[model samples]
Target: MKLSRFGGILSAFTATMALGLSGAGAATAATPQARATGYVALGDSYSAGVGAGSYDSASGSCKRSTKAYPALWAAANSVSSFTFSACSGARTGDVLSKQLGALNSSTGLVSITVGGNDAGFADTMKVCATDTESACLTRVAQARTYIQGTLPGKLDQVYNAISGKAAAARVVVLGYPHIYKLGGTCIGLSEKVRTAINAAADDINTVTAKRAADHGFAFGDVNTTFAGHELCSGSPWLHSITLPVDESYHPTAAGQSGGYLPVLRSAA
Candidate 1:
C-alpha cells in the first residue's frame, strides 16, 4: 500500500470552506443550531473530496476539497470543531498512522471511504482505460482477489482502531459507486470491461459493508445513491477521463453534493 495520486457543475457547487485540517479550530457557521458536536473526517481521496474541485491549497497533494462531504456536513450542521485528515492516496496503514490521531472520546461523528487504494483502484482504472480489454480484465481480476482475500482484515483493523479511540463516535463508512453505466453506449471500451470495473466496485462495497457492520459502524452504500448517474448514464455525477489526472474516476462536485452528501446525511 502506498499513498498514490488521485468535479461538478458551477451553480451546484457550494462555497469553499476554509478547512482547518488535522488541527482543532471552530468552524464557520452555516447553521443556527448549537455547534457543539466534534466531527473528524478520515479516509482516502474519496473522503478527502479529491474529485470535487475547490480543494483547500493547504491540503497540498492530499487535495482536501472544501466541497467534500465532511466539510459540507460540518458547514451545514454547524459542528463545534472539524478536522480533515483524509488524504489522497491513503491506504489502511496510512489511516492508522496518520489520520487516527484526530479521534478521541470527544469525537461525536466519523466518516471514511478507504480500501480502494489497498485494492489498487486508481491503478486498476488506469490499466482499464489505456490498456487492452484483456489487460483491463486481468488488472480488475487481480483487484478482486485482493479485495476478497486481504482487504477485510485491513478494514477490521482500521475499524477497531476508530472505535478504540473514539468510543462513542457514530462512525459512518462510505463506499464507492460504480464508475460506468452498464449496458450503455459508451465508446472506446467494451461493455465487458465496463462491467468488470463495476464488479470491482461491488466487491469493495460488499466487503466494506460487512466489516463496517462487524464494528458496529454504519456503511453508506453509494451505489444505490449513485444509481442512474454513472459514467455512461448521460448524467454522470462521477467523472470520466479528465484533466489533472488524479481527478479521473472520482466524483465531480455534483456527485459529492448530490450523490455522496445525501448518503452520508441519512447514514450519519
Candidate 2:
C-alpha cells in the first residue's frame, strides 16, 4: 500500500527534538528494584517523537527521535537494552507486520501509541488546519465514525498480538494528547473546529483505554499529564500550527519529556 501523503508530512515534522522540560508531575510506576533489561517501543509518530528535535539516523524513514518519551524513559530507568521500533505513520497493520519483530520473551517492557492513523487522524487535522470549518467538521465526523466503528477491533487485534509476542513484558498503551487548548484561541482554527479535533482525540483515547484494559495492558493517560500545556496554552508542550505544516500539532521535546515521559513512566 502506498503511504498516505499526510503520513509523509507527519514523519518530516517529527524528525527532530528541541529540548526543554517544565510543567507536569513525574509519572509514578511500581519501580522494581531490578530495572527492566530489555525495552521495546511501538506505535506511531507520537511515540516516535515527531515534534521533538533530533532524529536517530539509524532509524531511517521511521524518524525515531532520540528524545522521544520511550527513549527518555528507558534512559532514566536504566533499562539495559532498548529497541525503538515505533514508526512515523504506523497504523495497527504496520505494528503487526513491521514493528513487532523487536519483541521476544526477554522483553521486559513495551510502550505504544496507535489507532489514530487507522482512524485517519492526520487527515482530519489537515482538513481542520487548512480548509474551511465545514470541511474540517466533515472530516472530523468521518474520523469519529471510524473511531467508534472500526478502531476498537483494530486496537484489540494489535494489543492481542503484542500480548502474544511479549507475554511477560509489561505493556502500556499510550493515548494521544489534545491537539488544541480548550477554550483557547489558535490561528486558523475556529473554536468549534478546535473543539471537534479535541473531541476526536478524546474518542480515540476512550477506545484505546478500553481495549488496553481488555487485554490486561496498562493505559497511560496523557490527557491529565498534558493538562494546562496543550497547544496554545501559556506554556504549550505541543507545537501549534507551523510553516512547514508537518511541524504543526505535534509534541515538542518538552512535551515528550514533561508531558509524555512522566505519564508513561507512571503507567510502566
Candidate 3:
C-alpha cells in the first residue's frame, strides 16, 4: 500500500467527521488525537523490506519500502505518527546504536524482526545454496550453535532496550518465515539442505518468541500464515533468489502484504 501525504489529511477529515466537530473546533480536534497514536518500527533487512522492492529513496541504503509490512500496516491504521527506522544489514548492535532512539514513552506501538543476521543466516544460506550439501549442513550447524548460544543474549539486549525506550508501547517481535516448503523440493537446493535451513529458521523463531514473552512483548508468528507459501511452494510468498543476492530469501511484496501485514495487524 503506497500512502500519499494526503492520506493524513483524509484521516484528519474523517476524524473530524467522526467527532461531529464543525467550524474552528473541527481543525483543532483531529490533530492531537492523530498525533497521540505514535508508532515506531525497528530492526533489520526483513523489517526494512529488502525483497519487496519499490524502495523509499529518501531512506537511502536502508531500503525501506512502502510495500513493507510495517509501512502497509501504518497506512492502513489510524496512527498519529509513524517512524520506520529499520535498515538493511542491521544487526542487534546496529539497532541498539541507531534505531532505539525512535522509541520513547509516548510511543504506542513497536514492531521488529531481527536475529537472523546475528546468526549469520545469509552466509549459512550462501554456503547451502552454492556449495556442497555437506558443507551447507556444516554451516547450518554453526548457525544453530550461534542461535542457541550467543543469539539469545543479544536478542535480550535489544528487547530490553526496546522495552526501556518504549515503556508504554506494545512491542511486537515478528519471526522469520521458513525458506522452504515443508516436505517439498526446489531447484538447486536439496530437500536435506532445505530441511536444515528451515530448521534454522525454526530455531530463530523459537528463541525470538521466548525472548519476546520474557520481555512482555507480543510475538507475531508468521509460520502458520505462510504455511502454503514458502519459497518452493507453487505460489511462494518468499523470494528464493534475486539478481542482487541481498534480495534473495526475503519476502516478496505480496508476502509483505498478504503474509506479514495481516499477522502484524492482528497482533497490534
TM-score to true structure, per model: 0.86, 0.84, 0.86
Candidate 1 has its poorest 10 consecutive residues by lDDT at: 1-10
Least lDDT summed over 10 consecutive residues: which range in candidate 2? 18-27
Residue-level lDDT tens digits of model 3 in 147-214 = 99999999999998987877888999999998899674578888888889899999999999999999
Collision count for each candidate, in order: 5, 8, 1
Clash pairs (backbone) in predicted model 2: 14-50, 16-52, 16-53, 16-54, 17-52, 17-53, 17-54, 18-53
lDDT for position 123 in model 3? 92
* RMSD (CA, Å), each prediction: 19.1, 21.3, 13.4
lDDT of 2 at 214: 88
Predicted candidate 1 versus true structure: per-residue lDDT over 68-126, tens digit per residue: 98899989986768999999999999999999997887788999999999999999999
